[model samples]
Target: MGERYLKSVRLLAECLQGFERFVAEPVRRHGLTHPQFDIIATLGNTPGMTYKELGERTLITKGTLTGVIDRLEQKGLVERARNCDDKRSFLVRLTAEGDTLFRNVFPAVVAHGKQLFADYGDGDFEQLDHALRRLRTRLDTPGLVTPGGHVPADEG
Candidate 1:
């Protein structure tokens, strides 16, 4: 049981790294880092979002999100403005150039992802998706995940 659990954990971690590598290639080719691309992609085609919204949607940590947003701002791809609703937080929106870049890159990256998932058809990933979602839920749920990072026996 221990061996199997260890192997599954390693495989999942490696698969995540591999998937990031696969997606990062085209993003890098477009002269943007993964985080920058992520910011642009999330902020695209919207009026704007607050730092809190962006953090939630991007799943990037506060420290990393701030730096990534700073870099994107420096590149003139994103701009910040005072959030009219809240004085403490700023709203992040793409510039015209950023919108153009997002329009161009979003589809291309998605197409690249589709190519990678070409072998998967309808109904192929439903169970896997459910399993992953379950795992994420377990991880996020306090007291549901054990000290050793395993889900509760009842869940298992």
Candidate 2:
């Protein structure tokens, strides 16, 4: 049973790594790193979001996020403005140039990535999504005991 779960974990890691490598080339062609593209895609079609919100929405950690935002700001792709509702926080949004880039590059990159799933049917997608969500929910649940009948150290 443990071996089965371990195999799944290995496969999941491999899948994530492959997906990253597959999408990375298109992102690089746009002159952006994976994290930068993630931020741009997250902020695209949206008004703006605070740093906290961005951190929550993105895979980037708060520490790395500041640096990524700084680089984007330097490239004139994004700007930070004082949040009207919260004077202590700043709202980050794409510049006009950034929006244009997002409009052009986003769909192209998405299309390129979608090619990976070209053969996947709707049912395949549904099954995959359901399985992943179920795994995530189980992982997030508290007080889950291990095979040894004790809560994992992190869970405890």
Candidate 3:
């Protein structure tokens, strides 16, 4: 079981790394890092979100989010405004330039990414999606498996 688990985890990580590498080219061509692109994509069509919301939406960690936003601000691609509802926190939104970039780059990157999975049929996609979701749910559930890989027996 442990060996199988290790193999599955390794495959998952390799797949993610491959996908990132494949998609990162277009993002880099547009002068953005993966996390920067993530932030721009998240804030693209909306009115903006609080830093907390932005942090939640993007894959970036809280420690890294501020720095990414700071870089985007310096690039004149995004702006931060005082949230009317919460004076203490700020709302982040894309600038006109950033929106334009998102409109152009997002679709292009997505199209490029689509090529990677062009061979996958509808059934393949459905199966992959279902399996991934099931794995995610199991991982998210608490106390299903302990750190040592033992399932706790219920105490009556």
How does model 2 score by TM-score?
Answer: 0.87
The 10-residue segment of model 3 with minimum total lDDT is: 147-156
Candidate 1, residues 37-132, lDDT tens digits: the string is: 988988888999998899998888888889999989998999999987779999999999999999989898888887767887767788669878
What value of lDDT does candidate 2 attain over all alpha carbons?
A: 0.90
lDDT of 1: 0.86
Candidate 2: worst 10 consecutive residues by lDDT?
Answer: 147-156
- TM-scores of the models, in the order given: 0.83, 0.87, 0.87
The reply for model 3, stretches above 4 Å from the true place, is 144-156
- Report the C-alpha lDDT of model 3 over 1-156, residue by residue, as the tens digit: 667788978999999999989999989999999889999999989999988898877756778898999999999999999988879999899999999999999999999999989999999999999989999999778678656677766432
Ranking by TM-score: 2, 3, 1
Candidate 3: residue pairs that collide: none
Local distance difference test scores for all models? 0.86, 0.90, 0.90
In model 1, what is the error at residue 121, expressed in angstroms?
A: 2.0
